[model samples]
Target: MDSRSSDVSARQERGETGGWISTPVTTDLLRGALDLEHTEHGALPHRLPARARAQCSDGQLAMAEAQPSGVRLVLRTRATAVELDTLPTKVAYRGAPPGPDGVYDLLVDGHLVARTSVTGGNLRTVDMTTGSVETRTGPVGTARFSGLSAEPKELEIWLPHNEITQLVELRADAPVEAVPDRGRQVWLHHGSSISHGSDAASPTTTWPALAAFRGGVELINLGLGGSALLDPFTARALRDTPAELISVKLGINLVNADLMRLRAFTPAVHGFLDTVREGHPSTPLLVVSPIHCPIHEDTPGPSVPDFGDFEAGKLTFRAGGDPAERAAGKLTLNVIREELSRIVKQRAAEDPNLHHLDGRELYGEADTAELPLPDRLHPDAATHRRIGERFAERIFGTGGPFAARDD
Candidate 1:
């Protein structure tokens, strides 16, 4: 066994409370979650509230929201060592090799300090071809971080972005208290899987998370994978949430799901913005069109997974609809971008705070040559960083829509 494993084993043998104090997991200690549901084992964070969740029955949305993409525990403590108990539900494709364990990132005073992963948690097996699933319960595991500065400082434990994790217990060598608000602007963003951090290296490195850090804002991410379908409940959730800055990344998911045609798409975008305006009329709201995606640039979608490399443990996506369908009002990336730009222009005439950004500005044709999306859907880790940096410069720098103001 490695030294860390041996130390963890020794701690287990000595008892979990060996000079450790337990801190209750409460709302004040959590950031980026809209709701917290008490579970049999622990507290499960939700990006959407109970009412919103009840309105939608899409399994994909349920899983995506529960994954806690940008959720983290924030506390003020002087502990040199800390431990978090979690019950993580990990997904696995039946025909492919098991994925690596979910990662937990430890940050001290806003800098990454340690990264670890748990083992022996619940397993969710998925049959992609059949659209079936099976789940097996397993034991809870602990994520431990040791050898810290021991000086009074803020600490953040970022949950895995792609796994459903239940926050069970927090043990530390020092007393932990809620971190006081730093008076940063709150940014609430909603989008599809790309914004959901599908292939991000870790929780804190997701595009949204990275942008939040760069912009010096507290984030409330509603980037639900496979479910940014401009649902009413999502709009309502955004309306109710308090935020100084807001953005909605649209189009890719709509096309991929073939969820709507042009007739419904325009009004849907307007309706979504209208609902948000009800609660945040003057807030800086940026509407971003789909990012550069050649597969669905001109072709209509219902993107389908390509399983030709299933045996090789690889999977990619391809647009399944024909380009000719555009004549039938079928939506594509280009079409959606045009409509979104037009809608924003019309609305901005009445609402000065409303702004539109072409997603290609964040990732365009040139980026594809250097950082091609591995799945032709989600950006890789490097691309996530690139998008985050570009977003920060475009939206939070100088006279951008979300630029800082002194009143």
Candidate 2:
């Protein structure tokens, strides 16, 4: 869709509709397109593979929760039929995500073909890397899907890394009428599940999506569930994208991974932003801390939900360090919080354009008392709404970080 069209669409959503075509998707017209729309019902979880749990592949460790909408009409080219050695000119629907954990259900012309979680979002565009491999797509993994033709294909997927009880009505290629192009900004956000809508009722309700709606920008959510580990490649991707407003929600992932001490984390963050600056230079950048998590409330410790509890059909986060271990480990939320405060202050001092917000400000100990994660690691849909509202209040508006000058 064109920017002119998107702006007009945004206006319509905002009740400022005019000068744009507002067309809803119809089943007939939708048949012509290849796409998937997230089920409008509720959140779904990705059932990770056993290998993922055992090997801890980065791809497995940094799980991205998403859902497949479904695949539509397949247009086969002569060359594609021979490449994969599948049925000549048959529609192929398969998923092959890295590390082979989650599964995506595939449908051909609304017919269920197969279900596997090893697939990832098709790369509509290529992202850059820190070391400079300029490909126009994400890494390709071996697909486990079978028998379907490898012709022109469209597949929809549900991308959660656990369960699907929350998944609502599954939607396939619904006719998406887009307005013509108009110049507009695209906002790119990177963070934990909060940014990924871990609790938001739907795909669009996530805070980044909400904020994008409020500000009128295109959203490219690079929210990986456990994936936002402050990788340099991720920062490189951010720097390389053409984003109007950029933010990196930092605290929770670092805390959860327990990857670094204060010594390593502080410098790593600075370096990440510095690399982003090399590309964005002056784009407004916001660094968000983690929202409330009681496990790390007072003291930081190994924060992971108990799998045994999950397997027993219970969802709970048992701080790896119990009271006795916490005392001995010298790990506590206070340590992490103090370090985060320092990181932000130092970064702000160095770069006027850089901004930071401690996650607690969004959901603090008090708020945690009222609202807690199901697994004590991720927030729920309601919490997501609250977080988005708070973020809009602070980051939107003319003098806010989102509203800051690019220069």
Which model scores highest in lDDT? 1
Candidate 1 lDDT, 215-307, residue by residue in tens = 999999999999999999999999999999999999999999999999999999999999999999999999999999999999999999899
Candidate 2: residue 185 Cα off by (Å): 2.2
Candidates' C-alpha lDDT: 0.92, 0.52
The sequence of per-residue lDDT tens digits that candidate 2 reaches over residues 123-231 is 3211111212121222222223435554444432223223212222221212222223235576667777567656455444566656765776655666666666777
Best candidate per TM-score, number? Answer: 1
Report how far off residue 239 is in candidate 2 (Å). Answer: 1.1
What value does the lDDT take at residue 324 in candidate 2?
49
Please report how far candidate 1 places residue 119 from its true position, in Å: 1.3
For candidate 2, the TM-score is: 0.58
lDDT of 1 at 216: 94
Off by over 4 Å in 1: 1-17
